[model samples]
Target: MWQPFEYAPKNKIIFGKNSLARLGEITEQFTVKRVAIVTDQGIIDTGHVEKAAYYLTQKNITTYTFSDFAQNPTTENVTAGVDFAKEHQIELIIGLGGGSSMDCAKGVNFLLTNGGEMQDYWGYGKAKQKMLPMIGIPTTTGTGSEAQSYALISDSKTHRKMACGDPKASFRVAILDPSLTVTQPTSVMKATGIDAISHAIESAVTKRRNALSASFSLYAWKLLNANFESMLFSPENEEANMGMQMGACYSGMAIENSMLGATHACANPLTKNYGITHGHAIALMLPHVIRYNADHAQDIYEDLCRISGIVIASCAGKALARRIEKIVAATELPTTLSAYGITADAINNLAVEANEEWTAQFNPRIVKYNDFVSLYNKAL
Candidate 1:
């Protein structure tokens, strides 16, 4: 018999080539007037923030720009953003970049209303009160922060990344425009696309995986697998761009319901320590993690193999590992930690940290500290 589950907080999804043009209409739905546009310096450099601010200005909405967020948003950055929001009496937030901006927006909302540090809401459903309305506009195809209720925030002191979530932190609307993604460089596309693929694969094999989540993951995996290579090899193809955007969004939706597994658990520390992109870290660790999870989640791995069209018939765990290596090769992503300057000692420390990560609890395999150590050693 199948177990029961509840869906995530509902969201309004606006998707298309130029869906960002509807931002004003969507923000008005929540009766927002003064808005805080949370983003990063890179986004401002790309002029995406200016474009979003223009849209709000055209609608007669006052816009406040908060583009000081870091690549991995820290508590201090979030606190500063919250102070800015409060100073302007901002009624709405528009997250106008990748995961960092959206996460900073969520952190600002949490600190603004909840009256505490970002660490105060590190776990699940910690916020007891409501938050301001947020609209997320993703400029990249990865991270899927626009669709989820959680934010990945880092501790200022320890540099440990925390996953903060509350039902109220869920976005009121997500504007997915492939045109916005067109400005992303080849490196951004490669990293973020791999991150989306990891989300699908991890969600499908997680302990929380259910029928509803599996359906989303299957379709997301199919779309990502079908279009990732095309997008990488043929950057000018409109169809490939659309598929990547849609697939990334679907993977985000899947993670909203089922969460992620060992790959994310391991990747977080790599980002925190080495300053690697989240997707790049995941890609470096994913194939090895997939091999590890397959030992315990054989049936689910086989299902994913069939869905990804990686294997024609039943295959052993090694085959899945090899397929992931092939995918990594096609993307030209690093398959080993050594290529990224991650040494054995760092790997050991990262293993300790990864073992402590919240996502480790959802891994299909019972991940002990030694298991993390082994995986890190193997990845290196």
Candidate 2:
């Protein structure tokens, strides 16, 4: 009784403990000469960017660093990065931090070849030309931007995050070295790990979910649910770190085909106006959104609860809410907006913005403006 569904395009994934050391080999394989390393100042301060730059330098690939990107990348940042790359004649781009750096790199590629502002490509599949060669290296366990074809770029004028999609913006290769994530702050690790869990949970129950996407989501949920606690308890454990990285990557792949739902849609406004980290904002709102969606997608929610090993009397909406509450408690994430200094009145504007987010349309339950308001109020 299943219908045909389009499959997402595949890309190369290089994952391991020392996979970062292969950057030189990858650059040589792609015949890239001048490369731009896109990252933020915090990554540079961590010395990981220097390590990556050294690898490229040893292979005779001239590396230019772009550390001017903001925490939440804006269209202005993308334009500046594009200008730097063009002026330096860079042929390849390496995104070497979390989602912001990777997103900025994708934005840079989109503007470099398409010759338009980020606003022009706000919707899906807008790029007309091939993008420059790009590689993504994730230093965190969230967002999964390294494995996605879409980049979330903020508009400088309105400060709203635009979800821009193009096959050309996909990375040629993603190098996931879990070792790099060990240095993340404890709060960041916990928040991003919760974000990865949200991806798995959301993808499993999204309206677009199919057999293949379900397969990835189920395994991703298992991996994340099992290892997230281990990573929190033993942050430096290589095996646990690898599990988190692999789970996050799989969730990213699932999202590529199925997209995210109400949680992400609601979370975006918090990041835009409240100055919250993307992962933290998403984590804070996810449990309530999951409960909301469970009312409409009970069968899928029960399936996810079973896969995540949450014992319940039945596969009901309340059972899903209890299970999500347990996960949120385990992560030490804030479960309410008030805990994050957001007021109940803020829900009105956030609801207005969430209703306009591109991902809201894909939720299993139709997310109307009133629904967003309710969800925001519930979170508060």
Q: Which residue pairs show collisions in model 2? A: none
For candidate 1, what's the RMSD? Answer: 1.6
Could you give candidate 1's per-residue lDDT for residues 277-340 as a string of tens digits? 8888888888888878776878777777777767634454567678767778887877788989
Off by over 4 Å in 2: none
Count of backbone collisions within predicted model 2: 0
Q: lDDT per prediction?
A: 0.86, 0.87
Give TM per candidate.
0.96, 0.96
lDDT of 2 by residue, 1-380 (tens): 47478885657999999889999999889888899999988888999988998998999989999988788899999999999999999899999988889999999999999898899998889999988989999998877888899988999888899999888899999999999999887887887888898899888888888888888898888888888888888999888899999999999999998898988999888988988877778877787887787668888777777887777685456776776577678777777889889997788999999999888988998999999999989888
For residue 24, model 2's alpha carbon misses the true position, in angstroms, by: 0.6
- On a 0 to 100 scale, what is the lDDT of residue 263 in model 1? 91
